[model samples]
Target: MLSPMQLSKKIQGNDSSQRINYLYQISKKVVEKNPVLSAYYGNLAVSVAKKNVLKIHPDIKRQLCKKCRCMLIDKKSAKVKIKNKKKTKYIQVTCNTCKMTKYFPANKGNNHRLWLENPEAIVEIVN
Candidate 1:
């Protein structure tokens, strides 16, 4: 069976809606059981899309952000916090144009401590 990454590339310039649907189905199953792998497939799709864009225009890459699909930037500050004290981690990504926040892993362990070590981008909580 071809992986979702492979399916992503094959469907890009083709008239194969059926094949694309198949890949999307596979992605749905993978998401329900294994989230990390789902992220990998998503990254692959983004990478393929990026490469296709670069192949066509070549200049759009200079103005786009890889992670957020927003305007390009030399640097970005990402913030992390635990919301509600129930170990629910949240990510606050401040791009030049958008200040976006999202909740992530429900049970982050020592990785949550990184929020403390890096204070420049990460906000520290005192509770």
Candidate 2:
């Protein structure tokens, strides 16, 4: 098996999306051992996407701390809590390293979903 660094180098020759994904995976794997290095990889992934004008998936984006560029693993690198304010329920994620907090709406009885998660959003399937 190729090491992460070697795998990353191999992926760098491929498409932007694939590179971003590999970088993020490396970041997640390294977070527990070295958060700074994890942040570096995470930042690199974001930069790659930006340089190519590509969009990162919502699920991946949400798992990253915007301010610190680190992976947010629940109860590990970050704390997750369900909060309610003004009758709106939301999930709150607090990054332990940088203390950055992010909120996501999770109100019950609401049928809203991200565009990508909706079935109508897919127009074609590629094999």
After TM-score superposition, the amount by which residue 71's alpha carbon in candidate 2 deviates from its true location, in angstroms, is: 0.2
| Candidate 2 residue lDDT tens string, 2-111 | 66667766667768887777777777778888888889988998999999999887777877899998988876788878788988888788888899998898747754
Point out where model 2 deviates above 4 Å.
Answer: 107-127
Tell me how far the alpha carbon of residue 109 in candidate 2 is from the true structure, in angstroms, after superposition. 7.4
Best by TM-score: 2
TM-score between candidate 2 and the true structure: 0.78
Scored by CA lDDT, what does every candidate get? Answer: 0.38, 0.75
lDDT of 2: 0.75
* Model 1: number of backbone collisions: 0
Candidate 1, residue 24: the lDDT equals 31
